[model samples]
Target: MAFVQLLVTSLLILVTKADVAIDIENASSDVYWIGILANPGLPIPSNGGFVLNGGQTTTVSVPDNWVGRFWARTGCDSGTNTCQTGDCRNGVECAGNGGAPPVTLVEITIKGDGGQDFYDISLVDGFNVKASIQPIDGTGDCSTAECESDVNAACPEQLKDGDYACYSSCAKFNTDQYCCRNELNFHSLMIIISPRVPLKFQMITVV
Candidate 1:
């Protein structure tokens, strides 16, 4: 009986220190998933990540000093447990695995780098949905990071997702500039595409 009580007490303490909140919003009309990945050398709750319907908002707790990335998954088949984007190969929890690329990611580092929490939204893998992160009632540059503009609208029909998402240019074209690979077997292409690109025409050939 003493061991049981001690075990419960230890779990209670762990729950208390896990106070950081990851607030997620599904701004689109399709069902979305909240995917979590604990950085190597750090462990998140054994069971993490959940599902969310469109136009819904939810929060997940994070252990202090945790560092990880979050992303949204779409085109999932709950029956078959498959996803079109950001599939970690598990039904719900990522189990430490990361979402597939062409998915926007939000990364966070709590109590790190001079004892401060750092968070940012990223589009390096391209985007599917809009997402943001905010440190609720916290101090020290708790700025809001967000991506609202839908770049998929301008995606060429060849790469459109039937209104679901715009795939990364690499997924469709596999070019040196889009995939960030070297061309001609010995030349690196400079990455110059801005967060926003113009409608004016431009051309790129992979060969």
Candidate 2:
């Protein structure tokens, strides 16, 4: 499989108090279809999607209180507008649609409660590209959140999705323990498995 990496920067400017700037960069030699799914009633940036070629970068502006998830679609066929992984089944522009799993997700809630920003790189849906977020300029305990390891290289046989992605245990087995579907303490389980923390960022990268 070809190695793919994306670098994104979320630039929070002191002057632009009402908006945030997201700089998405494709650092690898591959074409990536960007997908953005914003909260209902909120405007979607770039009409919810765009394309980034290798070494190319694009900036998207959103409200300071924007809440959404961003992901990249790989191995996309322009003719059919579908991807081998992370396909939303709606072409390049997701338009509020989310990508299919085995996808690495960058979830964020800007200017959230108590005037804090929360962001995380999630693998609960599985893993396609190695991704990370780095906080540039922000208040409070700003730290990098990442899933930088090559999960696909070390994925167990049962969780392997060909050579492109790795399926999470829950996605592969659909069991209560893995999915926390029927668990009474689902929230607790989630915290143990995937913890969310406050983070401010200007850059995101996928490898």
Candidate 3:
């Protein structure tokens, strides 16, 4: 058996710090998906978006003395240099050629024995995300005893105003385990709206 870890991030710009809204348009049949709004800003118009199913199973088995963890951060239109050209711009009214919006982040997590798990969205670092798994019923499924610090803990922070940040990491496994058992894949997306992009939305679904 083997252990698996997945990370996903999304970015967007909020017009103000009051309105925040995202309309979950659709998802895959086999998997469960939810929408996350970050930064506690102004809710925007629900323009219809979706989270596709990775078309994969999330259950399997693990070897003795084996343990694993996964984490992810999302939501940025683009980096500084290339942002002005693509969806990262998010359809804002700008005077110059490269018009982009502010970046936001979301964190997600799932623990042991994949049987329809949900990682609640929380605030870690200035709209950044942090996710972890703990022993359910005070006894997680593992042959040997494990520690919390041993799990993945990579939470990124906001850099300067115009710079993009990427913070991610994973914990080491004691032995090989089946990835199929209780597995969780991720599908990331970006919503770009502007006079140029014209509501061009892009999504990448994976398991």
Candidate 4:
């Protein structure tokens, strides 16, 4: 019920000052796992934290005009069995396997575009997961005339009409509608999160 592997690499800096270097590998064998997202508050790492079997390298620094989108989320289980709840405490209700409904590792949404990104993951009964990208090239910036429109303030009873939820932990982002620009030029993304089964790799460097 748990098997994840992903790898994504991107860099497109077009200011044309002269500087282009892109290199990417690991075509496919299921990727293992990786993550490198520029915005959304930044600092996303704590599903289990740190996992990759072999062959991993990350170098991000896209400075010019800008365009980058990097993401990775593999497997989803740190092991050491950490998820306690005394018979579903707080409001006990022990049925068969103790009311099974807690496996972990199901929250992935990464659409591509640093120059047309592509990786649409899905899992919520509709099952459909396939992610693989292998093509690295660097330096090519200069497309910032600016044009933005990606707003969706959400709050139709916490939304579920179109389904794409993210914001619920005290809850406060209900349809005020003003947040989803997702375009802040200058590209750089490298992510890695591996779970050893038959894949491993990890290396991070940003300059």
TM-score of each: 0.67, 0.81, 0.20, 0.19
Error of 1 at 81 (Å): 0.6
| Model 1 vs. true fold: TM | 0.67
Which candidate tops TM-score?
2
Better of 1 and 2 by TM-score: 2
Residue 23 Cα positional deviation in candidate 4, in Å, after optimal superposition: 7.2
For model 4, state the Cα shift of residue 153 in Å. 26
**Where is model 1 more than 4 Å wrong at Cα?**
1-18, 23-29, 46-48, 55-59, 156-163, 168-207
Residue 138 alpha-carbon offset, candidate 1, angstroms = 3.1
Ranking by TM-score: 2, 1, 3, 4
Model 2 residue 23 distance off true place after TM-score fit, in angstroms: 0.9
Tens digits of per-residue lDDT, candidate 4, 88-107, equal 11121111111111111122
Instruction: Give the C-alpha miss distance for residue 161 in model 1, angstroms.
Output: 5.7
Looking at candidate 3, the ten consecutive residues that score lowest on lDDT are 13-22
All predictions: root-mean-square deviation over Cα? Answer: 10.3, 7.7, 19.3, 18.8
lDDT of 2 by residue, 62-91 (tens): 787778888888889999989988898889
- Candidate 3 lDDT over 34-140, as tens digits, reads 22221122121122112224342222222222222111212312233122111222222111221122222222222324632222222111112222222232223
Candidate 2 yields a Cα-based lDDT of: 0.69
- Report the C-alpha displacement of residue 141, candidate 4, in angstroms: 20
